[model samples]
Target: SCLTDTRMMIKLRAANEPLFTGRRNAAKAAWRAILKELGLQGKISTYQMAKKWDNLKRRYKDLKYPPVGMESVADGASSWPWFQLMNEAMEGRLASSAPLLTPVTQDDDHAPDRTPKHRPRPAPPPPPPSDYGPEPFGGGDAAEPSDGPLGDLERQWDALERDRAALDRDRAALDRDRAAVDRDRAALDRDRAALQAERLWLERERAALERDRALVEQDQVALGRDREVLLKMRSFPVSFSVSIYRPVSEREPFAGCRPGGKPEPARNKAEFFIFLNFILEAEY
Candidate 1:
């Protein structure tokens, strides 16, 4: 009885074998088609596929469950929401990590509003015709006359005349001072010229004195030479002597000589003649 039951079970499975084989073959072909379409056949490991599915699920945290069906499994159980969430998360991460890549809003990206908040306007002024001229003395229409204490226009004219006279006086005084300065300058020039002439005269006098001194020295030298010649002539002894007694007195014999006899001393007549010639030349 057990062998018969085992045979019956084998026949039953063999009778539906084609249908089961076809289902398994179709499942294999579908998986190959999905891997080829996603281009992750041999490149993606079972562990890597599971990690990608987990990451997708985490990115779409709003979704409570993974997508159903064999197509979802092939695509790592990812849906449109999952992709959108992942993209948004990547954008947020980029923005936080790099300040330069911050998302820009349309309103902020456009030119800012530059319209002024408030306008400036000039204040209105009083009418021109109503207050045309200066306000009458003290805020009244009829101005009080200026005739109290001080006269009117005539007194003002007199004051102006006095001021003009005083100015004229000052101008005349300044003119006089300028003339005096001119006279002083002229006097100084004259004095300088006189001093220069005096200096020139003194220089001439000094030159004349020098010339006179030179002439006097020449005369002194000539006198010394004449005295020297006279002394040379005087040094020789006289050969003759002159008798100073008159002829009548000569009857008495002269001293140091014999009367009417030969003279005891001989006289040098030639030296005496030369001495007399020198004395005569010197005297002339």
Candidate 2:
């Protein structure tokens, strides 16, 4: 059951954390997606999934940091069924005092005994009658070394050594996690810079478009003034001719026409102006 639970929790954490977009609605959407992916939308609600994860975290914290009066987990690894799995899942997210867990195999538990076997020896023969007055060291010889207080001291030393090793492993893991976080920060900074560049490019394009629009407006205004001038010119008769004849007595003289004897007819205003100019020249 613990294995199954841990596996489920791992999947949920993976799905939710990556899909979340920093919004409440997005988080709910991520939960829904996770439920759909796991085919548990109908059986389990998002609230339940959240509660289960919280419970798992709480349990992990309890094991990692036992109560004040209780002894710490000096064996390096916890005895909790799914602690190792949870540790892997929450590796960079949670702060844990526990060390890396190594599962014990059957071979490790059933290794061959290495303690030396006690061999029997023949009884020592009685010492020869001592002529010297009561040998001082006859039966007062000290007993062979027995593993009492010394053995306990050795066992404590071994436990302390294990605790130190576990602490070293924990420190190394923390260092690696820190490195990963720093990498993520650098990547985020690069992305921010890219987004800022894109924004500036959009602004420049918008400004260029504004300038083009202003030029187009000016052209439209010029065309409107030209249209008004052409409308005024259209008011004149489509066909007209002008011929002016003056005598030499006048200050201006007419050319190609002597006192208006005969003048060429003009078709349009342009030809009429030319005929007028010729008469003025003749008068001069």
Candidate 3:
């Protein structure tokens, strides 16, 4: 049961790897997610959880070593169908002796494969011994000299071929990268073109608005002149009249007036009934 739980926990960690991948707290996030799934949140720190994981992995590796009596199983025997079946059972069901350490040999699944450490270059074969030159001895058996100029030449050719292949790969990668850059540049150009078109449309619209505003101003000025002229025309009188009032006191006579357009002279102590009149004129 503990084994199953540990496997589940490991799987949980792997699942959450992408949750915070490439970020600063990726490990912390991964461990936290694992703990949450395992129902161990707040019960253990990520450091302690990682330590536990390392311990389990170490135990699993120990279990992967072949059992005490399996020495007779030659390395080539592993490829045999029965050996594969045995591996499967050990890795799958844990019913076999190897899987007694299921932490390592569960269902006979082979240990995780690792790349062999790079062996340093074989130090260029000592420059093919320049003092020996071409070996004239050995009855000129040219095909037999393993340490001769031919061997050196073959090595050099192999090295050149490797370099050429590496260069070809680099060139292909560069071409792919350049193509991606070109696609991005084209997209940028398209966006810029769209923006330019939008700007031009806006400018034309603004110009049209300006022209309309100018026309509205001119119409307003014309309307103002028409209103002023209409006011003057509406205000003209249809006819004209001039009124004159003559205030003549009875006690003092109307000394400046005569009844029938006659010139009158001044009088003393005279009383008379005064009259008033208004003159009217009509115009077409």
Return the top candidate by TM-score: 2
**Which stretches in model 3 have alpha-carbon errors above 4 Å?**
1-147, 230-284
Residue 9 Cα positional deviation in candidate 3, in Å, after optimal superposition: 50
Question: Residue-wise lDDT of candidate 1 within 69-90, one digit each (tens)?
Answer: 4234334324332344344442
> Sort by lDDT, best first: what order?
2, 3, 1
Q: What lDDT does the true structure give each of the candidates?
A: 0.41, 0.50, 0.44
Cα displacement (angstroms), candidate 2, residue 135, comes to: 44
Please, what are the lDDT tens digits per residue for candidate 2 over residues 5-62? 4466455564345444343333344544554555454444444444455555556656
- Which residue pairs come into collision in candidate 3? 90-106, 90-107, 90-108, 91-106, 91-107, 91-108, 92-107
What is the model-wide C-alpha lDDT for candidate 2? Answer: 0.50
Which 10-residue window of candidate 1 scores lowest in summed lDDT?
Answer: 102-111
Among these predictions, the greatest lDDT belongs to: 2
How many clashes does each candidate structure show, in the order listed? 2, 7, 7
Model 3, residue 119: displacement in angstroms?
A: 47
Of the two candidates 1 and 2, the one with more favorable TM-score, higher being better, is 2
TM-score of each: 0.30, 0.34, 0.30
The runs of at least 3 residues in candidate 2 whose Cα sits more than 4 Å from the true structure, single-residue gaps closed, are 1-147, 239-284
Q: Write one digit per residue (lDDT tens) for candidate 3, span 176-241.
A: 999999999999999999999999999999999999999999999888877776665456442211
